[model samples]
Target: MTTFVTLTAYGLADGAVLALAALGFVLIYKATAVINFAQGEFLLVGAYTFYSSFVIFGLPVTVSVLNGVAIAVILGVAVERFVLRPLIGRSPISVIMVTIGLSAILTAIMQLIFGTEARAMPPVLPRGSIEILGATLPVQRLLVVVVAAVVLTAFTLFFRYSRHGVAMRAVADDQQAALTMGISVRRVFAMAWALAAVSALIAGVLLADITAVDPHIATFGLLVFPVVILGGLDSVPGTIVGGLTIGLIKMYTFGYLDPGLADVIPYIVLVLILLVRPYGLFGETRIERV
Candidate 1:
């Protein structure tokens, strides 16, 4: 049916972006055991940076994109080195609270610098639409899916075979063992944050293309919590599955029910999944002795 095809297209595009964002959450958690409450703020900063460089400043798309990504990477490294590194042995709750405070700081800074207005970017993708069944799908949406797929594939290869990727995996598995093997745990932590920022930057650009750039864009990062949690916070592949499932559920709600309820659906699913599987469907269960 036309509705089915239309929903499917939107779902896949949205899901891909969500998966990208959620991957960042998983990477940081797996690598350093710190929940980055500021993940969404990374997206906010990247989107605004791109807007300033490309739209307001009139730079070339490639240059602006690189600038945005560079800013994200630098911020990630700086946060790790200055804000979090000192708290290395602190309680998880303390680190989590620090990230929460960091999020507030980042949000305040973004609002102060960018203001609260939404800024439209000049269309970078070819402006067009494709017909799917009886419904029309935007070429931009299709491009989002393609870009996400490429990034996912590239990262999969990187993690499976690359030296740095292997190091990260080892560090995640057991930090003490990795350190004993001569791996720089601090370096790995920094790299995880940097990669997470890169992923957030990509998601920010894609989502900004769909919904314009604004302070509210950062809230999309918050949405990733449900995706990561539903998929298993520590499971990368699960992020993809959770994203797709969330997207489909959202689209189904919009198509069959009220469009206004779309935003509420993800959290609803999150709650249900939490109730059913506290560790997530693909997440590993660790037994801690009291």
Candidate 2:
């Protein structure tokens, strides 16, 4: 049906953004076993940076976008080096709380600088709609899906084939083993944060293009929690699957039921999935010998 087709397109686009956000979360967790509570703030930062550079300062889109991503990369590395490095041997809870604190701090900084106003991005993509099976989708939304897919594919290749990617993977698997093999665990950790930040930056720009640049952009990061959990905490592919599934569920719920239901549905599904498969669909299970 036309309704189905339309909802599916919208859902895929929405899901792609969530998947991109979740990818960043999963990357950090996968590499460093650190659940970055500040991930959403990174999204906020990237979106705002883009807005400030491109919209306010009248910079070229390409240069502005790169500046936003570059800022995120710097923040990521700074957080790792200054905030998280000292806590390396500390308890996971401490690191988590620190990240949560970091999120609050970042949010405050954004509010102070940009205020609480919602901002619409100027038309960056070609303004139009694409018709598919009698369903029309805005080009911006379509671009979000395409860009996300490409980024995901590129990251997948990087992880599977690249030397540094392999090093990160090795570190993820066993830090001690990776260190024994002369792979610098610290370097991989820094790289993981950098990669995660870059992912967040791209997702931020895409989501901003779809919605707007606002404080609410940070919440997108929070919504990704369910997606990553559904996909698996440390599973890259799982994040993508979870994001798309959640996105469809939300769109369908909004279309068939009430708009209010869309907001609650993902969490409901998250709870149900957790009850069924705690490790997620593709998450690895570690069995310890006593």
TM-score of every candidate: 0.97, 0.98
lDDT score at residue 52, model 2, on the 0-100 scale: 92
**Prediction 2 TM-score vs. true:** 0.98
Q: Model 2, stretches more than 4 Å misplaced?
A: none
What tens digits encode model 1's per-residue C-alpha lDDT throughout 1-290?
98899898989988998898888889999999999999998888878888889888899999998998899899999999999999988898999999999989998998998888888888977679999778898899889889999998888788889999999999999999999999999999999999999998888888888889888877878888889889898998898898888888888899999999998988998898889997898999889999
Give the per-residue Cα lDDT of candidate 1 at 263. Answer: 85
* Tens-digit lDDT string for candidate 2 (21-97): 89989989988899899999988998889889999999999999889878888888888899999998899999999
**What C-alpha root-mean-square deviation, in Å, does candidate 2 show against the real structure?**
1.0
Alpha-carbon local distance difference test for all models: 0.89, 0.90
> What clash count goes with each model?
0, 0
Candidate topping lDDT: 2
* Best model number under TM-score: 2
